[model samples]
Target: MSEAATRTVTTPPGLLASLDPLLREWLPRQRWFAGKGRPVTGFSLVAATELLPSTATLGLYHLLVRAHQPLLPGHVGAEQPGDCYQLLIGVREALPPRLAPALIGHVTQGPLAGRTVYEALHDTRPAELLLEALRTQARIGGLRFERDPNREIRSGLVPRLVTAEQSNSSIVYGDTFILKLLRRVVPGINPDLELPLALARAGCPRVPPPTAWLVADPEVPAGAPQPVEPYVLGVLQPFVQGATDGWELALRELAKGEDFVAEARDLGRATAEVHTVLARALPTVTLGHSQLRLMVDGMTERLEAAVHAVPALRPHASGLRSAFTALDDLAAEGHTWTAQRVHGDLHLGQCLRSPAGEWSLIDFEGEPARPLAERRMPQPAVRDVAGMLRSFDYAARSADPPQPEWAERCRAAYCSGYAEAAGRDPRTDPVLLRAYETDKAVYEVLYEARHRPEWLSVPLTAVRRLAASGLT
Candidate 1:
């Protein structure tokens, strides 16, 4: 490696002092920490801010942070850990004078950080930020906090963070809010933070608001947020529960031989609503056909590469090109469509089926690898719609552990719901819709090959259907 490429990392001063050698070692070992493995010995805080205090009694400080910490080669795919931050939102009755021993040392911190001795047992301080987050979700859902999650979290409503393998941590509360925890911590507003906020404000249904995010205060000292650093560690919002994940649900329906045309329609309508909302919500930007063309061209190349690597996906390779060409044609028509925000990673798994047979979306935080700005930009909401419509097809076939008929019925129901809502007759734009589904399948083919090969057929079958229909 070059001199500059030795690959070790350092942190800002004044953070993680009390932990000593062990503390430093412990942080990197954490499942959530991206700077794991390579031994991030030093660090600094980019910013820090105190989150809103809890609404429920006994909830205390809620702080968000941004930090500049070391990068182990294994943690980041990029050259180095891009702008990232750490977040500590625990409550402390009285902050230790020395600030030693740390909060996460034990799970006890969130349960009883800063209240009277007994209150600590029933404490809501540490996770208080989450309590307030749940309140926001409840406000949106129009429900009251009938029971405390600390005690009755099971039935009523609870906002507790659930750890996921992604770069950050997640807090799923009331089975309604899903918070994505960003590990390598970055500063500035996150795309997920910005887009959802805009979506909620724009009156888009189905998608949740960004609500509150924990960013480090810019002026905080270096090395960790110090309970006061710079950078945002997590974004909190409403969670969607009891809803069948679109991917699994679709596959199940498909395995049972059910048509998901209706499900496709509902997804279409929701996507249209999102696009329509985006068109109005965002400042419109005019772009020539060049950008769209470039993107399509790139996607085509990616598809081909993926098919070559995985023979099963090879069959969809041509369909992918055809679909891209069709979308490209739409862009080239010179209608001058407006640019608005998009659910960058919009797809089947991103949505859910509520108990009411309704749908809700999760994961507004764009693709983790993309630049924050690009991911936040508003584009045709049609893109998201396209993503879902294609998903319906995936349902018709990809459902594993298999029920083909059930998948078909699900497809039909979903389509019915979406069409009734979007009002854009699928019949009117049959070609367009087919192209969208094919495109989506192509995307899936490539996506699964790279991330989860076992699921490759999910998209492959959809392409086969679209191609067999001679639609694209």
Candidate 2:
């Protein structure tokens, strides 16, 4: 018999019913919850498994629930499918003082009625279960825990939840490995695992390879066709001890009025190295006239949407449209550009510098809100360069009394470093580079307008400048 057959996998009856009221109130407030502004009208269970039976004093439950929300202003054909969320619920007879903050609420009227349920990752005992599962390569019902047999994980390591504000939750174990758990999940292979594993196989040192990972196997009816791929739930990778993210490093240097050109140049080289390896490991294609036209159209469409969402963008719409039109003009001339599997979302916050001055890229998941298929599609390497360039501009503007000259120097040095490593500078293709940058700025403007109204000026500043430049 298989190992999974011996272990009991069962969901406590009425567990979701008991937790519904609490989750409705608690889900929207979570930092990782994507439907922030929308109300969670209801939920439907996609899958549920009891990792530890609720009959025990301490229990753990794994749940994948679809959160239903109302559609936006425009009328649509049918109700859109809601976002799916992965949740780990911890049940205890009584809550202790330390676990107070993780509390969901006391279950009022079901099998777990009167028991306390909270976020399981916050409690060390439940958190340790994850490591042990990975260590043993356990399979519980639809959940599978996998690990690299070559890499030995010790029996016991203390786990602590990362408190940083992020779209996902991470737990660091013994300063050796960190497990990034995806809060909002979709089916298929996530690039966060796919790209790093590919790079690791090619002996690329720019990314930390995943040592262990979790996947949720889809459940299908006995006679129905099965899903071809599973959902990537979390990834465990080696932690870069005593490392600082590039964003914090840049801000600190800016605060001291120190020159950041050298560091920026080195970062550029690291990025180019990774891009080279990814190109060699994955498929690359040339975006011909038809594809290039489609890409340009996508950018233009995003700009129009942003203008509709934020009235402030209306004044700059025509100017921003020129950036996309320049690319369209080039495409009409039969110009083509190489596209490869590049980092979907590359920014200062995504790069880390170790104490010894080595750089590493993390979080290949791209923008969580974007569709998985789109994030995985190949794109021009300059798309990543444009993101980094915009990041430098953001850092400069965010400083007290903005320093435009500092940004210009850093941008130039970065391009120079990239040229040294990749043998071509992104600035050489001024039209494509400018178009990608303008598209990224439009994204930032919409994000800021929705989430941080006060920071709207940051992207608006870039909009005004990019608009004025008009693909110069």
Candidate 3:
């Protein structure tokens, strides 16, 4: 078993002497290691940022490793990386007087806050680098990380911010640049590393263009083995300033009973457009039925476990079972929807309405629970559209608990939108769209009931409708 499969421990002193040299052993011990749970066979340094002294461990490392993916490739595996992704990591700059609490072990600039190099940012005068980040907008997907909060009268210099998502707390200069420390890493194409480039290349009007990437070169530093693993990562792109957050925006529209008629319609069109582009860029590879069967079987087992986890979710097991059935049922109907690469998770909250009245998409990372492999599968574009419809319904249900009328409107607007783009021709007879919608609703019910109880109404309402209408 690899240390990745083991619990991460604080790095001891002697091992910290040479940060790079020890990383091969220590890196695997850390939680941020991206390469699934596979044992680290061997690793090579791909990139390193040591402009500072080796003792100064508070820099970043980009490491690459060769590991096993078990019966498959690294891209398709059960082990997934934790959320905190960054190219920068904190290192011990000097021998500790005794055992510095804050400066102990190489940690996230996060863990070493007021004690190490990261602490200097909050000092009376920040590092000169702060001046640069403060003055200009650090672009990463229309999100500019800035220094001046429009409140701070100090050195307008923006301190190179750590991502707000960090546990120790990195300030959000202006939500532009998020200095997320690499707390967990899963080997393969970093979504943050890969998404911006792909979307930009595909001309998917929503995401920002890739500006510059921060990577680690193992050879850049002396004897680093895991060079390609880019420990601390940050990507800067143009910021979409003053834009409303999609989640909040969705909530407001639902409350106002604002029929997202046109918006939903537009959403359908946008989804279709993006799918065409994604198919072109990623291109779909035919998924073997054996693989599909295994995926469906695995999902069934997982959903069964989920039902067991939360008793309220047990009733949903039947509906959940339906997803598996639907997969087979549809194919049985002689309307097999080929699996292809897809935007795993899509919903209203992942989209925004710019001041210019156009739809903008964000969060290309797919479903939070589904393994990356399943999420990357190209199933049906209708799945995406159905998710949005469920989202719209969810908003309405949450906003007006007493009104099913609103839910009805959501369903109409969404399908109206989807139909406009995907042709709504019911690829399968007897209008399989209802079954598609039901399939999505059942998923919504199971997922939201567990994660967001308050949002359960969206799927519940859809379920009621589905049960009443019959699963096509």
Off by over 4 Å in 2: 1-8, 222-228
List runs of model 3 lying over 4 Å from the truth.
1-183, 216-232, 286-292, 368-370, 400-403, 422-472
**Over the stretch 85-139, how does candidate 3's per-residue lDDT look in tens digits?**
2333334454344323223243333323332322232321223333343334433
Q: How accurate locally is residue 364 in candidate 2, as Cα lDDT from 0 to 100?
A: 98
Cα displacement (angstroms), candidate 1, residue 28, comes to: 8.6
Off by over 4 Å in 1: 1-78, 81-125, 129-159, 163-168, 172-185, 202-205, 208-211, 219-268, 285-288, 304-319, 326-339, 396-417, 426-443, 463-472
lDDT top scorer: 2
Q: Decide which is better by TM-score, 1 or 3.
A: 3
What is residue 9's positional error in candidate 3, in angstroms?
A: 23
Candidate 3: worst 10 consecutive residues by lDDT?
A: 1-10
Tell me each candidate's TM-score: 0.61, 0.97, 0.62
User: What is candidate 1's lDDT per residue for 1-472, written digit by digit as tens?
Assistant: 1232122222223323422333354555655554433555444434322233333443332222222355543465434543343544333444353333334442223333233211111223445544554333231111112212322223334545453355556656666555565665455566666666678777676776665554434444457545432344456565655668777766665556666565655665665566566667677776557867766676677667667767876665565567677767877886344456677777788777776766666677666655665666765555565565555555544445555555455455555655576665444455445655665666677667766888776766666777667542
lDDT values for all models: 0.53, 0.92, 0.48
User: Model 1 Cα displacement at 323 (Å)?
Assistant: 3.3
- The CA-based lDDT of model 1 is what? 0.53
